[model samples]
Target: MKHIFKFLGIATLACLTWSCADIDKDEVGDESKLPNAVYIEGADVNPVTKLTVDAAGGKSSFTARAANKLGSNVTLKFAINEKALEKYNELNGTHYKLLPAKYYSLSAENLTISANNISNGSIDVNVKPLDNELDASTKYAIPVSIASAEGGSLLNSSVTKIFAIDRVLYTSSLRQNGFYLKTTFNPPYTNLQEWTLSYAIKLDQNKDNQAVLSPDFYSRVTADGGLQMKVGETDDPKAFAKTKLQPGKWYYIAWVYNRQHVKCYINGTLDTEFDVPKVETFTKLNMSWGAFVGYVREIRLYDKALSAFQVMDNLYIETPENPNLLFYAPLDKNTGIKDVSKNHHAIKVYTAGSDDATEYNQSLITWQDEKFPE
Candidate 1:
């Protein structure tokens, strides 16, 4: 009876050992098989992709790929995920608005990975051009996600991709043919005790001794070869310097004024400063006197006086979007000018040789490539 019981116990132990070995073998075999997951190629480096494009023409694209080699073909489905965009916006404290799905389309909304080319297959995501009226500062985004995968699993870590779009700021060159753009001063300069006005200009030497910027009450520059500022309706304009500017050469001009004093800077160097009694208001800004011809780039107005360092730092920036900036005219469009400031001021253009003789004449205005005078 003892021998029979031992034999039965040994047989049961052998059977249990064989069952455990088989389970281990199955686990190893499964692990050896390549994982079947769809993911974006270079997701780590291109997690958040960005593209800058002109409003009128062009498209941007990126590729989505699958991981591992499979025995059969697999089809992956993609979709725009608004929820992913919302989450990203929340985390970044940004107002990156969503673009319409129509603006973007995949090479194949349903991408197929052939059995032979499983690891090498990919889908192309193309973004179409947007309207010119859209603000460049306001970023747009399209979040694309792998909605589903047939014969494969979607990679949880890299299932979604964020595509950001930024519009290129427009810039156009204008001739001195009495072409000038004007926009209202918001928070109006009427009550302000301090302010700064700055612009990039390249003057035609032939048009010397003409007013570069004029207000009904004052002129910022005169052909006399210096920065001039008039107090009230007074003819005795304060001259920054009698420095003759080279024609066809780019120059940065900045005027800072407070109740106590006014300072003028040329190319970031303080050229002149003078004491002045408190003034009431500055009404307008005029770019040229019909005969004055040159190029104008970024024109900015600040509510507060900017320091020399600030002026120098801002010289390199083609677009000045400062918070204190009350008015901005990039002068980038070929026909109609735009004010890219918070005020959304009205812009008026005056063209030379117009029969209408109106301040705003679209007929006579012409634009070319904005080239700063070297």
Candidate 2:
């Protein structure tokens, strides 16, 4: 009887020990085991990121990260979610137009995060250079979302990332329907010896004789059906290219003049060169009906005669950063014109019949939908 009781006691003790060992193993093993929920590490903190680039073209980048470390490597896939972009635009009161998917490309569409990399795993997404065709006034966006993860679950709330391209205020196209800009020469320009005038123009119709740069005494014109530059009181005009101005085409026109010589350029090519009498002084510029009748953008004036290279360099108005630039008018304003140069000249618009003596009265200059000439 004593032996039987002893045997029963030992069996019960052994069973109890085995059960406790099993419980301990489950607690120790599963304590560090976490559910795989992957997400962009900075998505919650910075859900939206902004990028800016020149209208010319440039690249931008962003990053995504996993939520938890894993025992093995895992591949993650990402895609641009158009619906999410629309939602973001609506919520943020933004008109973020979606660029094509080709614009937003990932360095690795299927990024693999290894076990060691899981702790600090991240994937880079590169946005291809934006084309110059994009509208300067419009903001664009691309929303990236985690599509899938091989060994992890995606965090729904933090899966999406927003990237926006900032808007750039660039040159504006002006319609010919009687639109012109005049500057208030407060400290009127005077005592001019050497000067260079450059502008980009597109004419819808040619005028028999029209002033392009008329500053009281000195004038450059499309006179007698040709590009002309006149100096002195007698209007001794030097003409170039008898061919009529082509309608709806862009032309870069430049005039470099001094006391001894005058040079004209069209589209970076020297059109004409001649000797001219020196002019001692001149007044403000007048760009009314007799001056412009079509789209004119990026008008610049230099105090010194620009070299051939300088004129060619400024053919495309990328940025207004010339040291010798005295007056620059991007003419990119929606309501009124502005001189974005060191000399902030006052710009005033006028109606055709306004009694105001200082105003250039013509049809109101309306802003064109396209900022550049088509």
Clashing pairs in 2: 351-361, 351-362, 352-361, 352-362
TM-scores, each model vs. reference: 0.49, 0.50
Q: Candidate 1 lDDT, tens digit per residue, 326-367?
A: 777766554346667776577777665453256755656666
- Could you report the Cα RMSD, in angstroms, for every candidate shown? 15.5, 20.5
Worst 10 residues of 2 by lDDT: 26-35
lDDT of residue 185 for candidate 1: 53
Off by over 4 Å in 2: 1-171, 217-224, 235-237, 241-243, 333-336, 353-364, 369-374
Candidate 2: count the clashes. Answer: 4
Best by TM-score: 2
Writing each residue's lDDT as its tens digit, candidate 2 over 1-374 gives: 23333544665575577774664454522423434566776777777776544455445555555544666777778888889888875664445668767666666666767774553444555565666676543456778888888876676777888776543344556554443456657676667778887777777666655556666544443533466666655555444543446767777888787775878888878887877666544456656533457777767887788777557645645344445667887665453467777778876665433433556443455656443223
Roughly what TM-score does model 1 have, to 2 decimal places? 0.49
Task: Tell me the TM-score of model 2.
Answer: 0.50
Ten residues in sequence with the least summed lDDT for candidate 1: 26-35
